[model samples]
Target chain A: MFGTGQFQLYNPVRVIYGKGELKRSAEIFGVSNVLVICDPYVSSNEYFKEVMTGFNSVFIYNKIIPNPPCELIDEIIESVYEHSKGAPKFEGVIGIGGGSTLDTAKAVSSLLVSEGKLADYVEGKKKFEKRLPLMLIPTTSGTGSEVTNVGVYTLNDIKKPMTSPTFWADIALVDPVLTYSMPKRVAATTGLDALTHAIESYWATSTQPYTEGLALRSAKMIFESYEASLNGEEWAKDEMAIAATIAGIAFSQTRTTAAHAISFPITSFYNVEHGLACALTLPTLIHWTYKFISEKMDDFVRYVGFKDVEELAKRIEHMMEYSGFSLKLHDYGVKEDELEKIAKVSVEANIINLTPGNPKYEDVLEILKTIY
Target chain B: MFGTGQFQLYNPVRVIYGKGELKRSAEIFGVSNVLVICDPYVSSNEYFKEVMTGFNSVFIYNKIIPNPPCELIDEIIESVYEHSKGAPKFEGVIGIGGGSTLDTAKAVSSLLVSEGKLADYVEGKKKFEKRLPLMLIPTTSGTGSEVTNVGVYTLNDIKKPMTSPTFWADIALVDPVLTYSMPKRVAATTGLDALTHAIESYWATSTQPYTEGLALRSAKMIFESYEASLNGEEWAKDEMAIAATIAGIAFSQTRTTAAHAISFPITSFYNVEHGLACALTLPTLIHWTYKFISEKMDDFVRYVGFKDVEELAKRIEHMMEYSGFSLKLHDYGVKEDELEKIAKVSVEANIINLTPGNPKYEDVLEILKTIY
Candidate 1:
C-alpha cells in the first residue's frame, strides 16, 4: 500500500572530516606514488610539501582553471603519460582545490587508466569502468564536489554534468583548516552554494528520509555557521566545512533542482560566481516551492530555528546583502530580455523536473521575471 | 581548533526501501544461484517463493535460532558445502528474517569464502577479508541488523557482539510488506528496539552530526508511528520499517550506549526479549544522561516533538505500558539482589563507556534500583 516511497540510498565515499587531516592523505590513500591535481594556489600553500612528505614519489599538476574544460582534463592525463613515459607508475590520484579542480581531477583519474579523452566520457560516448585509487580534498566550504559522484566539465562552451560509478572517490578528506585561508568573498559565495544544496535537496520530490535527515541537519548547520564562517572564525569555518559535505551527500543521492538548473546560464552569461549564481535564484525558488512542500519546509524551518518559510527566505536574502551581493539579476548584468532565454535553458536540464511542482518553461520564466 | 570533532562516516550498503522490494531482490543482488539464510517462519511465508522465483537456483537454510550461536552458523556453512557437492557454485547470499537470522547470514557469507570456523572469527582469532555478495532483508521492524556491520552471537551462553568490515551487505532491501504480519508483541518489542537505537546512538559520545541527524529523524518517525504500527496499521508499519533501518545506519556509525550495554545481561539472565530488555533501562538512562548532555538532549526532545526530556522518558514508559510489557525487573523474574550483578555485567561492556555520563558500576546499580 505504501509502495510509492521507493528510493535507493548509496554513497560509497569514505569521508574523513576534521582539521589537520591533509597530512594524513598518504596514510589514507595507502600508496607511495601519486598524481596530485590541484589549483596553483593549493600547491603554493605552505602545507603542500608537508602533505606530500609521506609519498615515495609525487607529480603535481596545478594548471586547473574554473569551469574546467574537457581539453584541460585531457591535458592533465597526457602530462601524466609524458611524465611517466607511458607507464602506470602512480598508485593513486589526489585532488585538492575547489569544485572545478576536483571535477577535473575526477576526469584525469578515470582517463589515466581507461582509454579515451575527457570529452568522449563527458559526452556519454564512453563509460568509465575503473580509475586509479582516488581521493578528494576540498579547499573551499562550498562546492561539495569532494563527496559527490558527479563532475561537471565544460564541453564546447557548455557545462555538462555526468555521473559514473567510478567517480565515487575512495575518500573525501574535509580538513576545514584548508578552508581557513579562503578569502571572505569566496567563503560567502561557496557558503551560499552549500546552503542552496541543503535547501533544494530537502524539498526535492526525489528526496527520502535518509537524505532528508542529512539535508535538515546540514541546512541548520549552514545557517548557523555561514556568517561566522565568512567573518574568518575558525570554529565556524570548521562547522561550515562539515555541513557543506553533508549537504553534498544529501544532494548526491537526490540531485539538485531548479536553482541549480537555472544557475548554469546565469553563471555562463553574466560571469557570476557559480555558487552566487545558484543562490540568486534560491530565495525565489524557496518561496515558489513552498506551497508544494509547505509542511516539509515548515519542518525544516522549525528545525533550523526559523519562524517560518518567509523568514527563511528573508534570511537568505539578508545573507547575500550582508556579503555585499546584490540579490537582483539586473545587478549581475542580466538584461530583462534575457530572462526568457535563461528560463528556456533552465528547463532544458532534466533535473529541473525533480523539483516539486515540476516548474515548466512558463513557470520558470515567471520565476525569473519575479526575481528580475 | 575543531580537531576534536574529527570522525569518519562510511557505509557501503546499498539500501532499497519500499513495499514489494523483496520481489526485486534477484535484480538488486545481480546474481543467479543463491544461498538464503532465514528463519523457518520466513521460509514458510507466502511471499517466499515469489522472492526466489528469479534466481537460477536456490538453497534455503531455515535453521536460524535466536541469539545465533557460533556452532549453528558453522553447521549452516557445512550444510551448504555438502549440498553443493564440494563446489562453491552459489554466486551470492541473501538473508531474510529478523535479527538472529540476518546475523547468522552475515557470518555464513563471510565464512564461505574465508578459511576457518565461525567460532575462530567470533573469538577474534581470525579476520575476514572477503565474503560472497550479500543482501539482507528485514521481516521485522526491530533489531536493525539489516544495515549494520555488527553481528551478535552466543559463544559460551553469553551474547558476544562482534563487527567485521565484511558484515556490511551489498544491498539492504527494506520491503515493509514483509513486516505487515508481525504479531503485536513482536511489533512492540522491535519498535522499541528501533527507538532505543535511535536514542542511544543520538546520545553516544562517539556520535557526529551525520549520525545525530539520522537518529533524530528515526526517533521522530518511531514516536509518530510506533503506536499505529502496533495496532497493525500498514502505513505506520511502513514508516517503522524505514525508521528502523535509518536507526540501524545511525548506530552502525556510533554503536549503542548504556541501554544496549545494560540489555545483554538482562536478556541473558531473565530471558526477557532483547528489544524489550534493552528498553527496560532506557527511561532511567535518559534521565541519568540528561545532566551531562542537557542542551543536546533538549534539542533531540524538541525535534522529536516532546516538551522536555522528562516528558520524553514518560512517553517511552507509557509506550511500554500500552504494549502490555511490565517496566519493572521484578516482573521479569530478575531478583532484587541480582541488580548488582546486572550492573557489573553492564559496566563491563566496552560500549557502556560510550554513554554520555560514562556510568560506572555503582551508577548502573542505582539506575537498576530506580527502574526496579
Candidate 2:
C-alpha cells in the first residue's frame, strides 16, 4: 500500500485473452493484408498454422532470431515493401512468439512509418513517427514483451541488446494455450526472466505505487507457480502465463534495472538464454544490493512466499538447478579469457545506469566473477 | 494470492493524485475554457474557488443536485450551448464535487456531442454520438464516480444508476486536499459508501481477478482509514480518497449488486444521503446474503481488517452512530405508512436483477425489516 506521489500510467491496448482468441485475429484486425512475424520454431508448429487458416493475404516472416539481429529486421522490411508493390500497405503486424519475435515485430512496426534507421530509436531517442497497427501474442509466459513499451535488439558487431520506450505494442494477446506447447526448459527460462523483470521493477529507483503493485503481484505469482509450471501442472502453467504478462506490463512501465543490466551482456556475449542469464545474476545481485534496498528486498521475499531474502535466493537457485539451467558462466562456455571483455562490455552498455545503487566497475566485475 | 482466469486489465486514465494536483488542472486541461460542474454546496467553498482560478474562461455550472436530476442536466446543457456561442466550445468538462456532480459531468460530457436527450442513453441504448473531453475531480472519498463508468440519476420518479461500457473519463484527478473541508458526517457516510462498493463488487457474479485485487486493496484501505479520515487525519484522508477511487474503478467494471440495488430506494424515497443509505443497508445485506456469498464475505471481513463478519457489521454500526448518521429508517423520519411504498419501489427497480446472491422478494423484505 505504498503511495505514488503523482504519475501517469496507461496502456491503451485491448487485450483479447482466451484459448480461441487467436481465431478472432481477423475480426480484431479488419480488411488488411496482415504481416505475421513469428519465431521459426513457433511458425512451424501445426497449431499456429491451423490458427492462420482464418485470415486472408497473410505473409509469414519466420526468420526472427533469438536476441533478434538487425539484418533479419531489414529482411522483414524489404520483404514487406517488395510484397506490397509501393502501396501504403501492411494493415497490421501480428507478432507470435517469445520476446525476441515480439521485439522484432515492434521494431518493424516502428521503423515502417519512421524515416530513420532502427539505431535512431534505440534507448530514449525514440523518433517513431507512426506504427503499423501492431498485435503481440506471446508463446512463453515470461518476458511480457506483448504489453511492454520496450524492444531489445542485438547489435551484430557489439553483441549487446539495445532497448527503447517507443517500442510499445498496440495489442498484446496473452493466451495460455500458447504456453502449453513450451518445453519445460523454455518455460523455466522464460518464467525466471519474468521473475527477474518483476524483481528489478519492484526495486527500481523510478518505480511508483502503480508499477510496484503489479510487480509485486507478478513476483508472487511466478514464485508460487514456477515450480508447478516446470513440473508440467496445467493450472500452474496458466498462472505463470498470466503472471508473465502482468510482469511485462509492470516492467513496461518501469524498465528493468541492475540484474537486467548485467544479464544483457552475458546473453549477448555468451548466448545464454535471456531468462536463464537474468535468473543466474538475480540472486547474486539481490545479495549484493540487499543492504542498500533492504526494505524492498524484504517485501519482495515475503511477497514471493519466502521466509526471508536468503531463502528467496535459495528458492530461485533450487528452481534453476531443477530446471537444468546453468548458473555459472563456465557451464555456458565462457572461458577465463572472456571475463574481462564481458565485464568491460557490460560497463559500456547503457543499462549500467539503471542500477540504482550505482555499482562501481569493480562491483560489476565482482558480480560477473561470482556468477562465473 | 488469487488466480484470475485469462483477463486483460489496464486503466489508461492519467491519475494526478495528491494535495495540490487540483491547482495543476489548467495544465492538464490545456487552454480549454473549462466547463466546471459541481454541487451547489461545493460552489460556495473557498477552496473550490481557489482551484477554479487556475482555469481560463471558467464556466461554473453548480446546478447538480443529489441523485443528479435530469432537469438540472438539461439546464446545464442549455447553458453550455448558449455560452459557448458554437465556437471555442468547452475543451473539457471538469467535475468538482461528490458523486452527483461527477456523475452529472459524465452524463453531460457523453451528451454534449450527441443528438438526443439524456433518457435516450439510459440502460446501454446510448445515442449520444459525441462527447466533450471530460475530467472528473472528486471532493469526497466515496461514490468513486470519478473513476467509474456508471452514473446514477433520478428520472421518471425512479432512482437508477445506469452503466455504459464506453462511458469513461479521460482523466480522473483525485486530490485529498479537496476532501479536507468535508464534515465528520460526510466523511463517515462517503467512506461507508466506498466500503460497500468494494464489498459488493468483490461478491459480484461478474467479479474477475483484476477487480478482486483492486476491491481487496480498497476494502483494506477503507477499513484502516475511514475512522481516521472522519477524525480529520490528513494522511488517512488521502489514503481513503485513493481507496474510494480504486474501488470505484473496480465496481465500475463489475456493477454493484444487492446492497446498492436495495439502498437506492431509501435515498430516493426517504431523502437519505446516498452514502448514509448505502451504509445503513450494508450490514443487514451482508448478514442476509452471507450464506449465499460466504466465501466473498469471509474474504471481505479479512481484507477489511475485521476479525469476522459480525465484527465488521458492528464496526459499521458503531461508525454510523458515531457520525450522527441514523442506522434505522425511523431515525430518518420514514414513517410506518411509507414502508410499503419504499418496499414496492425497491422491488420494482431494475437493479434488483443485478443482486449477485439473487435474494428473493421475501429476502428483500426481510433485509428492509432488519434495517428498520
Candidate 3:
C-alpha cells in the first residue's frame, strides 16, 4: 500500500565534494579536449585558472550574459565547431561560472548535435536529443545551476526555460574555493536564493520521498551557515556550496512552485536581482502556505530548530534583510498600485499548479500586499 | 564552516521505483538478448514469466544459492558463454531474485569480460574494468542487493566481499509486487537486515553529506513501516522495497561499519540467518555506541520521536521481539563461552576501523556477552 505515485528521479551527476574538489576534478573527469564556458567576471578570477589546469586543449567561451541571448549561443556554437575541426571533438563542456554561463553551456552543447535554432528549443517547438558530457563547477552557491536540468535564457525579451534528459550534467564539481572570493553582497543574495529554492521545493506538489529529505537538509544547512558563509567563513562557504548544489538537485527533480513563479515578473519588470526578488515574497508565502502543509511545516520547523511557522517566517525575513535584500516591493521601482498586476502575472504563470493547494490568485494578491 | 572531510558520492543507477515500476522499466531500459538470473524458487514463480516478455531472447540461469559461492559464479559464466554461442552476447544481465541471485548477476557479469576466477576479485587479487549493462529487480525486500555496488559470496567458508565501479547496476527496477509474495518470516528478516544496513552506514567513517541523509531517512522509513510490511500491508511492502534499496545505496557508498563486521563471522561460522544475526546484537550496540556519539545520538533519537537513548534502545529491543528475531545468542545454540572469539574475529575483520570512535574488541565482547 506504499509507493502510490508515478514519478521519476533521474540525477546522474557525479558530485565530488570536499575542500579541494575543483583541483581534484580535472583528473577525475579525465578530459583531454574541452570547452570552458564562463561569465565575463568568472573567467578573470584566479579559481578559473585552477579549473582548467589538466586539459590538453581548452577553448574558452567567456561571454555569457545574464539571461543569455540566442545570438551569443549561436556564436559560441560556431566557434566550438570551428575549433574542434580535425581535433578530437570536445570530450566535454565545463561550465565554470554562474547561472548564465552554465545555461549557455547546456544550450550550446544541445545546439552542437541538434538541428534547430536555440529559440525553437527553448520555446518548446523543437526537441533536441544530443548532449555533450558536461562538467559543471559553480562559482556561486546561489544559482544551483550546476545540478539542475533546466537551461534558462532570454528569448525575445522573455526568459524561456528549456531542458531535456540530455541537459543533465554528468559531473557537478562544487568547490567552495570558487565562491570564496565572492563579494559579501553577492554571497548573501545567492545564499538566500539557495535557501528559497530548498524551501519552495519542499512545498511543491511534486515533492516526494527523495526530494523531501534533500530539501529539508539543504534548508537546514543554509539556515545554519548562510550568515557565516556571507562573512567569508571558510567552513560556512563550503557548507553553503554543498547546500546550494543539493537545493538545485531537489528543485530540479520537482520544479519550483509559486515563489519562483511570482518572483519572475518582479525581476523582469522591476530590475531587481533574481535572488532578491525571490526573497521578497518567500517569508510571507511560507506563512500563507503553512495552513496547507502543517505536518511538513512542523517537521521542517522542528528539524531546523524554529519554534513555529511564524518564527520560521520571521527568521527568513530577517535573513533577507541581513543579506541586503529589499523586503518591500516599493523599494524597487514597482509602485504599490502594481501589486494586483504582479499577482495576476503570478497566477497566469501556471506554476501555482505545482503548489499543494493550488493557491488562488486572490491568495497571491494577499501575499503580495502583505510583503509590500 | 563545513566539509572538513574527503569523500565522493557516485550513484549512477537509474532506479525506477513504484508498484508498476517493473513494467515501466522494460520500455525505459529498452534491452534485448538478456541473461535473467534468478533463484530457482523465483524462476518458477508467476512473476518470472512477466519479467521475460519484453525481451527478444531470454537466457535463464536459475542456480543461485544462498551466500552465493565462487564456484557457482564460474559455472554460470561458462553456461552463459555456451548458451549464447554464435548469437549476440547477452546485452544486459537482469537479476531478479533474492540477494544471492542478484550477487550472482554481478559476479557473472564481472567475470564475462575480465579474465580471472571470481574468487580473485573477492580476495582483492584482481581488478576488473569492463561492465555489462545490468538490470536488478529484487524479489525479496531484505538484501538491498539491487542497488549496492558490492557482491558478497562464500569463498573458502568465509563470506568474502567483492566490488568495483563496474559492478554497479545500470537500472534498479524495484517492483513492490515482486515482494508481495514474501513469507512473513522472510519479510521480518529482510526488513531488519535493511534497518541494520541503514544504521551502520549512518555511523560509518566514510559516511559523508549525501549518504548521511539517505541512511537516516531509510532507517526512519524501516522503523515506521517494517512491522506493518511484515503484517501483509501492500503499501508498507512498497515502502520497504524503496527503503531497502536506498539503504543499499547508502551503505554501498560508505561501507557498513562495526555492527556488520561483528555480524559477518556470526553468520558465517554459525548457521544463523544473516538478518537474525545482525538483529541479535543491534539494540545493545546502539546502547553502547550512544556513549561515543552524544550529538548524533540525540539527533537520531529525537528525529525518530524517542524521548532519549534508553527509550530508543528499548523500542529497538521490542521491535526485534515483535519481528520474531531471536535476541539471545544462547537461543541460537551459541554458548556464552564463544563471545570472546566472536569479538576477536569482529575486530580482526578490520571493518571496525571504519566506525567512528574506533569501537574496541573488548567493547564488542561486552556487547556480545550482554546480548548472550
Best by TM-score: 1
Q: What tier of docking accuracy does candidate 3 attain? A: medium
**Clash pairs, model 3 backbone:** A1-B234, A1-B235, A2-B235, A235-B1, A235-B2, A236-B1
Docking class of 2: acceptable
Instruction: Provide the lDDT at B325 for model 1.
Output: 94
TM-score of each: 0.98, 0.87, 0.95
Better of 1 and 2 by lDDT: 1
Tens digit of per-residue lDDT, candidate 1, span B43-157: 9989788679789999999979899888898888888899988967999999999999899889999999989898899889999999999999899998889889999999988
> What order do you get sorting by lDDT, best first?
1, 3, 2
Error of 2 at B265 (Å): 2.3
Error of 3 at A240 (Å): 0.7
lDDT of 2 at A293: 79
Q: Interface RMSD in Å per candidate, to 1 decimal?
A: 2.7, 3.8, 2.2
Which candidate would rank higher by DockQ, 1 or 3? 1
**DockQ, model 1, C-alpha based:** 0.58
* Candidate 2 error regions (>4 Å): A1-4, A30-32, A123-126, A155-168, A203-205, A283-311, A326-372, B1-10, B49-56, B123-126, B281-358, B362-372
Query: Cα deviation in Å at residue B226, candidate 1?
Result: 0.6
- Give lDDT tens digits, candidate 1, residues A165-274: 99999999998889998989999999999999988888888988888888988888888888888888888999999999999999999999999999988988888998
Query: Runs in model 1 with CA error above 4 Å?
Result: A1-3, B1-3
Q: Model 2, range B223-340, lDDT digits (tens) per residue?
A: 7777778888888898888888878867766777777766777876767777788778888876776887676667556545567789988887887887877788888888876776
| Model 3 lDDT tens row, B1-372 | 236766666777777877766655457668777888888789888777888767788888887788878988888887777776843388778888888888888877777878878988888888988867888889888787878788888888777877788777888888889999998888888888888888888777787656666776677778778888888988788889878887888887888877778888788678777777787777887777776777776766665567887887777778888977668888887888888889989998767888767879888888898888
DockQ of all candidates, in order?
Answer: 0.58, 0.33, 0.53
